[model samples]
Target: MKIAITSVGQDLESKIDARFGRAKWFIVIDTETNQHQVISNEHNLNISQGAGIQTAENISRHNVEAVITGNCGPKAFTTLNSAGIKVYSAVDGTVAEVLEKFKNGKLKQAGGANVEGHWA
Candidate 1:
């Protein structure tokens, strides 16, 4: 499966960014082949508003199956859910660490947005 992990930098070694919308980068990885790519979220990182919705739209375009992040807001969560993308919340540690947890089925799946909009 292809999963996107919110990251502080471009690589798996980078720390996971807690905020979904304002994350610096997203590390998209394929679990089977172990291939990966980094997508930057520079535009949404400091937007005056609507960052979560915009960022969620951008991520959905990548066709990622799931998202790993510390927090997700209402608009973003609703948007992602509409696209059939699963959101995993309260995730921490490096991109690699979370990937491992996901692979092991240890990460928690979020039922709904855990934070309010414009949270970050």
Candidate 2:
């Protein structure tokens, strides 16, 4: 399984970014191999609108099975859901820490959007 974790920086030690759409980076990890890649989300940060949807589309192309982030807005949540990607929100700490929690089934899958659209 490949999971994408929103991050403030490009590595496992980086703190988790609270905003899903405008997060600075996404650390996508392949659970089976323990390998990962960093995807920059800078382009979405300054968008006037549709950041959430755009970000969702961007990550979907990476084929991540799930997304672990601090928060997810309505549009992004729906988009991810439509693409068969699960969203896990309200997560904190470093990317490595959350990855362990997810691997251990300690993280809860979000049922729907935790925040409204246009959330920064």
Candidate 3:
């Protein structure tokens, strides 16, 4: 499975980004080969609205199987779901920690969007 995590920085250790479309970068991890790649999101962060739409489109384009992020809006959730991609929100803590939970199936699917728009 291919999973993508929104990150403030390119490294896997970077904090999970709150903003989906305007995030600095997305760390794409291939679960099978364990290969990690970084992709830049060049949308204008200042005036960007409906970030969820763009985010969903981006994830769909990448053929991502899952998106483990801090938050996802309504549009993003619907778009991802229609595209057959599961969106896992409210995933706080380090990237490595979350990944471990995911691998072990310890992290169950979450509901309810957070107020801070991330993993608060």
Candidate 4:
């Protein structure tokens, strides 16, 4: 499975970013081979509006199967759901730690957005 974790930096050792839409980077890891890639979310970081939706759309293009993040808003959640991507919210710790938790089935899938839209 391909999982994308919101990260504060480019590497797995980097801490997980608490804000999904405004996260600095996305660490996309393929569970099968342990290969990964980093995607920057710089464009959405300073956007005044539509950041969540835009971020969601951008992630969808990467073909990630799941997203692990600290928070998610309704619009972004809806967009991801429509694209057939699962969301695991309210997560913390380093990107590597979170990835391990996910692989071990320790994380819970979020049923809906955990926070309101326009969250910083």
Candidate 5:
């Protein structure tokens, strides 16, 4: 499965970003093939306001199966859901660590949506 882990930098060694849609880069990791690519998030701040559509489209383009992040706002939650991508919250630690948790089925699914203006 293709899992996207939000990271602070361009590599998996970077610490995990607290927000999903606003992360600096979405580290796309392919579990089966062990392939990984980092997708730059050009609008970490603005995406929260009006780029949900674009973020959803970008994620769809990657054929991502699920997203692992520390937080996801309500708008993004709905947007990602509509795009047929599952989102799991509370994924802390580095990008690689989070990916391992997800692969081992240990990452917790977000119990609720985050409030707007919570990330900043």
Candidate 6:
């Protein structure tokens, strides 16, 4: 499975960014191969609005199966859900740690957006 983890930087050691829409980067890891790629989210950081929605669309286009972040807003949650992508929120620690948690099925899947829009 390909899982995206919001990050403060572009590597596994980077701390997990709590905000989904405004996260600096997303470290997408392929569980089977252990290969990783970074998706920059700079474009959405300064948007007047719709950052979460736009970010969700970007993630969906990358064929991500799931997203792990500290928080997700309503619009992004809806968009991701519609695209059959699972969202896991309230995540913490480095990208690598969280990946391990996910691999071990220790992370909980979020049922809905944990915060309202513009939460970042």
* TM per prediction: 0.96, 0.97, 0.84, 0.97, 0.85, 0.96
lDDT (tens digit, per residue) of candidate 6 on 1-120: 899999999889999999998898999999999999999999999998888899999999889899999999999999999999999999999999999999999998999999887645
| lDDT tens per residue, model 2, 1-120 | 999999999989999999999998999999999999999999999999888899999999999999999999999999999999999999999999999999999999999999877635
Give the Cα lDDT of each candidate: 0.91, 0.95, 0.74, 0.95, 0.77, 0.93
Quote the lDDT for 92 in model 3: 76
Error of 2 at 8 (Å): 0.2
Q: For model 5, how does the per-residue alpha-carbon lDDT over 7-118 read when each residue is reduced to its tens digit?
A: 8899888999886666778889999987999898876447435554466667778999888878777777877887788889766798878877777888777645655634
Winner by TM-score between candidate 6 and candidate 5: 6
Candidate 5 regions with alpha-carbon error over 4 angstroms: 44-48, 117-120
**Cand. 5 TM to true fold:** 0.85
Give the TM-score (vs. native) of candidate 6. 0.96
- Per-residue error (Å), model 4, residue 89: 0.2
The segments of candidate 4 whose C-alpha lies over 4 angstroms from its true place after superposition are none
TM-score of 4: 0.97
Model 1 whole-model lDDT (C-alpha atoms):
0.91
Candidate 6: give the clashing pairs: none
lDDT of 3 by residue, 4-116 (tens): 88888878688888766567688888887878888777663554466676777877888788888877776667677888887778777666677777888876664533433
Residue 98 in model 2: lDDT: 96
Model 3 residue 57 lDDT?
A: 82
